[model samples]
Target: MTSEPTHAEASQTGTLRGSIGVAGIVFLVIAAAAPLTAIGGALPVMIATGNGAGAPMAYIVAGVVLLVFSVGYAAMSRHMVDTGAFYSYVHKGLGRSMGLGAAALALLTYTAIQAAVYGLAASTLRDLVVEYGGPDIDWWAWALGLIAIVAVLGYRSIDLGAKVLAVLLVLEVGIILALSVAVFARGGAAGIDVVSFTPASFFSGSPGIALMFAIASFIGFEATAIYGEEARNPKRTVPIATYVAVIVIGVVYAVSSWAVVLAYGSADVAAAATADTAGLTFGAAALFMGDTASDIMLIMLVTSLFASLLAFHNAISRYVFALARQGVGPRSLARTHTRHGSPHRGSLFQTLSAVIVVGAFAIAGSDPVLELFTWMSGLATVSILVLMILTGVAIVAFFARSDVDKRWWHTRIAPVLGCIGLIVITGLVVDNFALLVGGSSVLATLLLVLVVLVFIAGVLISKLSAGKEVDRSEHEESRT
Candidate 1:
């Protein structure tokens, strides 16, 4: 077991506290709501149409790259346990400056994904509400309802969050798995098409475009660190959870995506996505749901989207709370509830931030996915890659500087390999940014640009805040 940060105050202490056990930890790591969010299914559909048999291979490739990155990430987490998100990991390993930039990026990346999903949820639900109730209500209103539910859950203990995630995880993974088996049971694609899981498929696309989608699929996994402050045992729990989450999710994606390729026939999968890539394709849903039942799947997806938004909102807030507690963001954001012991202030801020963003987009009439995932996802991926690379390097630097002796392979070899892989993958994703957000409405681009600008602005604000702290300290001494 590794030591958590002195600042965390050990929420469940001494009595075998972390209590989350392996079960809770696994659920948190899987983040079940994400796979069900339409992004996973859509990516597979796009791959089949755009690249032929190569799409599932892309997922395999992405999973491998991420698995390599997790080696160093989990290693670092074992030593440093702060809910500060990536910023904290980099800060302790790197410095205050790197931490600030990382924090800024995390905020933008997560918030954008959450809000974008809201737009998706709203649009899909609006259609559902009209069809089911024959009444047209504002989608934003429904989105507001989701925000409230997330706020309520966030107010509860972290363990409750884990429970909720566990239940959702089963649903998301179960449904996807069911579809995969159903497709395979019928010998749907005519053959197994085992070749779809190779590197050849990954490089077939412009590879750059496929990489961007691949990176987006992995974003939710990073939230594992946010649970650091709450984990039953940060050292053992964090490292294992980080690796397990990536590996498990990656495999599920590879298997499920390959299953889709087999079912649809590589030729058909690509075509479906190319036609309307971001929109949910209901061939399987329609198959299971019937013409009238198609509405049921749509409704379930909308629910999943809403849940994803809330989950992210919870993550972003915890990140802000982490920074605040360290005196980086507004000091008030750091406050935790005296009783629930939750990051009450941070949760409130996250919900409010999301509400403001959703309202802004609704007013501007923006395209949610294009705006949410494209630009925002791009920036987030960039930031996370930067953090992952820095964290990997930080592990090396800390061990070298501290003279903390450990196995060279655990400390050196793995991280070095991981860093190189991440650096390359991140560059590829960012370079092909346009491919990801292609033809998204102008408003979509502008809003994402604005989101990036906000992150940049955060860096400046962090610096100013640090300066004020120094000045205030000096003034107190002068008075003495």
Candidate 2:
């Protein structure tokens, strides 16, 4: 008779295979953040609705917080290795139960963010087509088409994702850089101004809101560890990529937002942003490099959204694979492609979820940007902030008893401080949740409850499943 496969043997079926270097991982993380999307889509909102001229300063401060978080995070990555990432680290530091809970939270967060981008991409693509005198296609039609494309790519080799992201990221960042350089070269409506970097400007408007947007832009920086299994020399590559991504994203965001302030006088930026909330960046591009540049920026904006969608799709698929491998989800989900070594099953599941979400919103006749993008993305930001705080605490817990590396600062001091900072940020997110989701306190509360319940459900299912297996083994022993 054939022997049944052990759990450990069975779990090896869908292992990821890649030798992605730091540059490759960085490309994926930065592409997920989508520099152009942040600049053209989120920056003007930050300027008009958040901290006005002080928005750039908020990016600097947010960057500092993440860099500090990286200190403990990088250290943890060295010792604890798993693609489950946040969940795996939490398991090593905390307990398996808490780790499973974290896995559920991570899945929720990534799924929501991916769906949010689909909504944004669909709407943006629809407008882009209509602007050029194409037929008025429904946003859902575009969203469905893009989902099919992403599904195909995400089910392939990890290197394919990296290569595609690298190309899209370069073009998007290049266009934004060109626009920023033009803004600085032409001087301001007034003269060149450094007011955006000043303390007074930093405190001038709703800095809390600005900080929220700035932190949101750093969404994928923590995902370096999610690809740990695929990364070549993961310990070194993960840390380097994490640090580089944070600093690069921070500098680019601050510089670009500052240049926007300079293009319009610092004193007048809020008014300008308000007047043309949707077209402010394009208007600046038109003024500096002519209508042709503005057109190019608009087209790149669509591609930028597509790049982000693909990046997040891959992230969510990996999370699913990690969970299924550990028996937290369907066993079939853990199986990888024989030739490509891709988590094809998980990719399909994630695509199906996206379809359901996008379809539901479309059927309800909700405004894609307002209802789908803002609400879902805002919920994801809040969920991720909670995970960050938990992971920081887990790092401290992990090191308090062990003496493996023996670096007090990395294990203790930095982790403690990072946890505190993230805690404060979480509180801010909670307090401003209504504002983040466009003043729907009820919806914000519902999302928070949903996240909590999902976590609890995961923990209970794991515990119950373990208990059942133990009981069955005991019964067999009694029979023998």
Considering every candidate listed, which one attains the maximal TM-score?
A: 2
Model 1 Cα RMSD, Å? 5.3
Lowest summed lDDT over 10 consecutive residues: which window, candidate 1?
10-19
What ranges in model 2 sit over 4 Å off?
1-14
- TM-score per candidate: 0.87, 0.96
Clash count, predicted structure 2: 0
Return the lDDT, model 1, position 245.
82
Candidate 1, pairs of clashing residues: 18-232, 48-270, 49-269, 49-270, 49-271
lDDT by residue for model 1 (209-255), tens: 56556666777777677777677777788788878888887888777
How many steric overlaps are in each model, in order? 5, 0
**Candidate 1 vs. true structure, TM-score:** 0.87
Instruction: Give lDDT per model, in order.
Output: 0.68, 0.87
Residue 208's lDDT in candidate 1 = 61
- Candidate 2 per-residue lDDT over residues 64-145, each given as its tens digit: 8988888999998998667888888887888877888788788888888988999999999999899889989999999999
Off by over 4 Å in 1: 1-19, 38-41, 48-50, 275-281, 285-296, 369-375, 440-459
